[model samples]
Target: MALPVGIFALFVLMVLPIPPLLLDIFFVLNIAISVAVLMVALNARQPLDFSSFPSVLLFATLLRLALNVASTRIVLVNGHEGGNAAGEIIESFGQFLVGGNFAVGLFVFCILLIINMIVITKGAGRVSEVSARFVLDALPGKQMAIDADIAAGLITADEARTRRREVTIEADFYGSMDGASKFVKGDAIAALLILGVNIIAGFALGMISHGLSAGEAGELYITLAVGDALVAQVPALLLSIAAAAIVTRVADARDLSGQIGGQFADPRGWLPVALILAAIGMVPAMPQLIFFPAAAIAGALWWTLRQRAARPAPVEQPVEEVSPDRIDIADVSDQTLVTVELGYGLVHLVDKDKGAPLLTRITGIRKQLSRDLGFVLPQFRIRDSLDVGANEYRVLLGGLAIAHGTAKPSRLLAIDTGEVRPGHGLTGEATRDPSFDCPALWIDPAARDHAVSEGFLTVDPSTVIATHANQELLRNSDQLLGPEEVRALVDDLKERAPALIEAIHPDPLGLAALTRIFRALIADGIALAHPQPLLTSLALALQKTQDFDSVIDAVRADMGARLIARICEPGERLKVVTLDAALEGAILGGMVDPGTGQPLIEPDCGSMIAERVNRHIDEAKGPVALIVQPPARRALAALLRQRASRCLVLSINELPARQPVEVVGVIGADNPAHQLPAPTEEVQAA
Candidate 1:
């Protein structure tokens, strides 16, 4: 209601004749509004903080233009009466501001017009145009960065949505600014034209209507004309400056004044300024009095700033006394199961002042892992260590370093996952991705869009570290489970199915046996996220035998379909890489490990088998299973666990009867025999 009423009033001011007293009030109000807007623009930390500035500027321009129309009417109609015939504000500008000289007032008004139209308004308009273009061009890349963060588990869905909204608001604000700048430019031109009309009309009206002499008409009418122009131009200049300030801001955490002051606070900058001023002061033709005093002020500022810079930071005294003989366990050991230690240079990724992006990403990873593994993982501890390289970080499981990688804290990693176009011409520090060993480059953060356009997946330093940690956690998930985790799993299951829990715990299988079986299942790529069916299978398997091996075998055989589902989708034949019949026979009757009495393949044979399986796995580019007899399953699984980790090892009994399988290749066969024909539809036992 207020906005509509104010807009109606602006139209009324332009259409109806305004009294001199009311005109004066409107002039002062316009000037006040312009000043208040300038102050707000200067204090804004970012352009989006003043999102309403464009609309405000439009209304303010209309008000000023309306005031100009009303003031022009009064000046032309009341010129012959006196200088005060129009308004006190205009009279002061004509006499006091320019000293009663119409020529000087005209000169001042023209200079103000030039500054507003050519210097400030022009530059601000150009900046607004460029800013809008760049913002719109980078919109896609910015959205991609948010999506990448979400995919890397650095932020949740809600945070991503908020970031996307902010990006949209920023684009809209700059776009509006680009259009609103024209208002300021047009206002300046309109003021110049109004000045011309006021002077010509007032000059002719005074002579023609009141029969005044040429000199008297010029003196009275021209002075008021220049005064009206100057009055309007003053506020116009202020508004132009305000617009310039708003568009030129660089989105800092501090306001305009604080940002400038902080950048100019360096003592070294002041010292050079003092030297330059002092050198100029010594010249014979220069004004030594002014230059010397300016030099002294600079020198004094430098001295004061240097003293402040040199002051040592205050240190706090310890409040507690400690005995030398006492030893704390926390200082010597880490209680957390997973620990991430970063070098000094990478510590900023975890700094709370910078939003602690690494901490947030790690928390997201933990949540994701807990959901996948079906248990609450222990809290991961992050700390700084001086032993590692400045850019290196290590992931420690149970205080032992399992995986380590280097990251550039100030740059982004653009990974080429075999999709980058040839001759992309990217220049940076060449490196390999630590997580996947893919070709990558450590490029400047500014080149993220270029890299993305070139088909490279660019990720920030925090995302890189979090991804490495996520991969390592999944690989070593079996070790992460313990008695406490197993206990918690059983307790949670008890609440949902107390009868099933009673059948398994403390009777045939105790906590220790249950923990070991769950660990084995997890190691074999069977997740316990759905505990009801898995625990039920284990309870039923226990009724047949108490032998640990037999119990695991029965449970795995019952859950064979679930294990196969992890790798192969339904309605698709599973690709199987198997050993030759002779090779399997030799392995079944091979030398045994004395400790566990399990069949062990010779070293050379094991390496050859691992190499051949890896080749087939790579060629397939999907999950492949190695089918062997029950006795050889353990040995082959252990051999391929490191070399061909993607290959799922399954025994004859563990393979589902109804599941369709394709024998992709056979290891330990000649090159011609390697390309074997597809077998029958059903899976055949090895």
Candidate 2:
């Protein structure tokens, strides 16, 4: 309401004749407002801190122009009387301030106009135009950076919102400054025109009406005109300087004075100036008194600066050591089911304040894996490590590093999805995709479009780290499903089917044995997406046998069809590599220590079987299983676990009867030369 009323009153000032006392008060108010604006501009740490400066500058310019009209009215109307026509503020400028010389006042007014119009206003306008253009051009890149930080989990939603608001305000301030500069330029021109009118019109009217001569009228009226212009121009000059200061302000945490003093604090900077001044002082033609004293002052400043520079820095206090009794055992523990350790540089990837998306992404990964695996994944702990290199992160499982890699937040990784040839396209730091080790290039963000067009998949550093963590979580799924998770699963299942759990547990299969079976199934790359079939098979298997291995085998056979379908391409015939008749007979005959539950096979025969199966697996494009008789499945699986962990051993009874089977390779028969001598012959001789 105050601003609106003030603006309206400024408009009224142009129409109604202002009293001399009110005019002086208004003149002082204008000076005070301009000074306040200049002070605010100087103290503003960032341009956005004073976002309303352009509007204030506009209002100040209007008010000054309005005062010009009122002062002009009083000057032309009453200058025929004397120099004290307008008010004391005007009279002081006309007499005491300018030594009662209208010529000196006129010269001063012209100089102020030139400085404001040619120097401050013009320079500020150009800076505003350039700043607005550059800020607008960089807006998209800045927005992307913010979004990338958010995705990386560097900043929280609230912080991102605040930062985005600041960016908008900054752009708006510059754009407004660009337009508001015109007001100052126009005001300078108006001041010139008003000065002309007050002098010429006052002289003409005074000579014709008051019977005064041209010289008397000119002397009297011109003084009033110069006084009015100077008073208005003084505030105008301050406001112009304020505008220039704001437009040129760089974004920083320190105010203009602090920034300037900080930058100029170096002793080395003053030493050169001192030397130049001393050299000039020694010249014969120069004023020895003035130059020598100025040189001496500069030299003294340089010497003082050197003394400050030579002073030793204060030593930091050492950190106090904590007593052993005060240490918490949990704080020193390294036992976490899953942990993500980031280096100092990559810490922004988990900082909610900066908008890093890694934490959120890890949560999503855990949720998806937990849902797919039929058990809730344990909460993964994240911490920053100074021991690791910047941009490097380690994915730890049970306090051990499972996967680690380096990523650059400011750059994008363009992975070649077999679309672009390796070492082709844009030049960059050649690297591998951390998750899959696929060939990739770390390129600048500006080259993302080019990389995409050239058939490369571009991703930021946060995505790369998240992907690596996700892969590690999947690969270590078996270890993640511990006793606690199993107990949790039982508790959840009890809510829906309490009778089913009561039927088999404690009496036949204890919780520990059941957990082992689940772990084994997961280790074999089987998703527990549907738990009913596996649970039903476990219950039925417990009725027949108490052996956990036998129960696991039974569950696998029961879930074979679904698991097989999941592994193979839709509608494609199952392709598997099988052992020869002799190898199967020998393996069955060599099985020993049945009471001990250890199906031991001859090492030579086991190695030969593994070598052949691994070769076939390596050649296959998709997943292929090893088909054997039902009795040999568990023993052979255990024997080949270390050598060929990827080889899936499926019993003939487990799969559909009369199932279409394409024998791609006969494991032992295809390489007859690789077969070992019979264990029976060596044993009989011994």
Candidate 3:
């Protein structure tokens, strides 16, 4: 509203006659405003700090032009009376400042106009144009760098958004200045035209209307004309200089004077300049007085700067003392459920614009594992780490580094798929696979086709990190489940099977107990994808006993088919790698009690069984189940849990009736496969 009203007043200024007092006030206001603008331009540290400068320039230009029109009106109508007909401001410039000579006032006005139009305004426009063009050109690259920093975890999402906004403002400021510079150029041109019109028209009105002699009319009218032009042109010149200062100023953290002073404060840079000036002073044709004084001043400045540099900088005093109570434990919580920390070189693996597959692969892993495990997989927090090698990445579980490996961002990883042609022999740069620790090689992307032909599995750096992260999530699925996840399961169950959930032991089998049971199941490699039987088994098991081990045993018994499905494919005979009858008997004998369900195996016996089972696992072609008796199954699974990650201990009752069994290998026995039963009808059908 104020801007429109001001513009309306500017138009009214041409028609209305201003008293000399008011005209003088407006003239002073114009000069003061121009000085204020110049001061602001000099103090601005960056272009964005004065983003409103371009619009201010446009308004100031219009105000000066409007004032010129009003003063022209007054001069033409009343010039024959005296110099004061226009205003005291114009009269002072005409008579006193110009020594009552119209010619001197004209000369000063033209000189100001030439400086503004030809030098300052023109140069400022070109600078604004180039700055705007360059800023626009660099905008996309700046945006990409911000996004990369966000992905690399060097900055948070909020910081990235702020930087993007700054980039936009910088581009907009320069673009506005590019167009606004035209206002200064036009103002300079208009000042020249206004001066000419004021002189010619004022002379005509003085002679025809007031009937003055030619010499008298010329003297009186020309004096006021030059005065009005000078008053308006002075403000115009100040504004042009202000515009030039704004456009030419480079961005720094300090104001113009501070920047210049700091840059030249060093004696090293100015010593050579001082020497040059001193040498020039000694030349024959050079003015000795001017050049010698300048050299001495330069030398003095250099000496003073050197003294300042030799002095030690004062230490800064702390404003506030740090207290022990101010230490926040939350700052070091360190309870990250899952995270992937990338080294700087692997930072590109998380960049979405680069089509990095790590984040997408992690999402897919969460989705697939959630369905397979019957519990939501926790989100993995991806970040960057400077502590590791540039090509390395680490997978963390529960804030502990669980696995780490290196990848080549510009190369492909080709795993020895175990089916390579003879003599091919893993030909590329050998490395261990991050996901499974399988022997693999990093090969150039150009060699990917050849690697694939040689039966190697080729993957990129992103896929390598992602696969490793996914495997870790699955392997540590039990540790990842929390009370919050358990509550989510209960809430979901209540929606579909309210009464079934309600029937469970509310006193002994709450969310915590259920979460423990699920953790135990997942720890033993049980998939909870079908929750109905597990819930039903838990409801029944809790009715019999509140003991956790017994209840977990019953749940495992009830999930027998689901567990078997994990080890055996559809319609395939289940391969058995069992223990010798004697070893099984010893394990059963080692049990402290069947009811208490304690395993008291001797150390030597326990070590021997673990070694045998691990050996069998190493020899197996694919997944194989270890069939044990019902009483010893829980204790034996617990015993092998630490040593053999792949081995599954199953009780005979847990086996599906229709599935046929083949004894492929046995722990603690020789020729175990030779002891296999001849094909029964069920085995033949399978």
TM-score of each: 0.54, 0.54, 0.57
lDDT of 2 by residue, 1-686 (tens): 99999989998999999888999999999999999999999999988888999889989998999999999998888877787778889999988888989999999889889999999999999999999999888776666666555544457657878888878887787889999999999999999999999988988888998889988987888888889999999999999999999999987989999999888878787778878877887889887788778877777877887898899999889889888779787888855578788889888777655654776677678778888898877667778888688889998898888989999978999998788855556868999998877988999999998898888999988889879988877767888888887887777778877777776665566778778888998876676676656677778888888776677777777778776775675556676888898878887777677585555778898888888888877777555678898778877877776688667788886775434556668866855323223235445466
- TM-score, model 3 to reference: 0.57
Clash pairs (backbone) in predicted model 3: none
Residue 488 error for model 2, in Å? Answer: 25
Off by over 4 Å in 2: 321-686
Write down the RMSD of candidate 1 (Cα, Å). Answer: 11.8
Question: Lowest summed-lDDT stretch of 10 residues in model 3?
Answer: 671-680
What lDDT does model 1 reach?
Answer: 0.89
Off by over 4 Å in 3: 1-5, 267-306, 315-338, 342-392, 400-408, 412-460, 463-686
Candidate 1 local lDDT, 1-686, one digit each (tens): 99999999999999999999999999999999999999999999988888999999999999999999999999989889999999999999999999999999988888888888999998999999999999999898787666546543457668989999999999999999999999988998898899889878877888899999889999998998888988889988888899999999998999999999999999999999999999999999999999999999999999999999999988889778888888899888767789889999999987755667897788789889989998878777788899899999999999888899999999999999999999999989999998888999999988989999999999999999999999988988999899999999989888999999999997877889889999988888788899999988988898899888888889889999988898899867888988888899998898999987789899999989988888888888887999998988888999998888889999989987767788888887764333434344542443
lDDT of 2: 0.82
Best by TM-score: 3
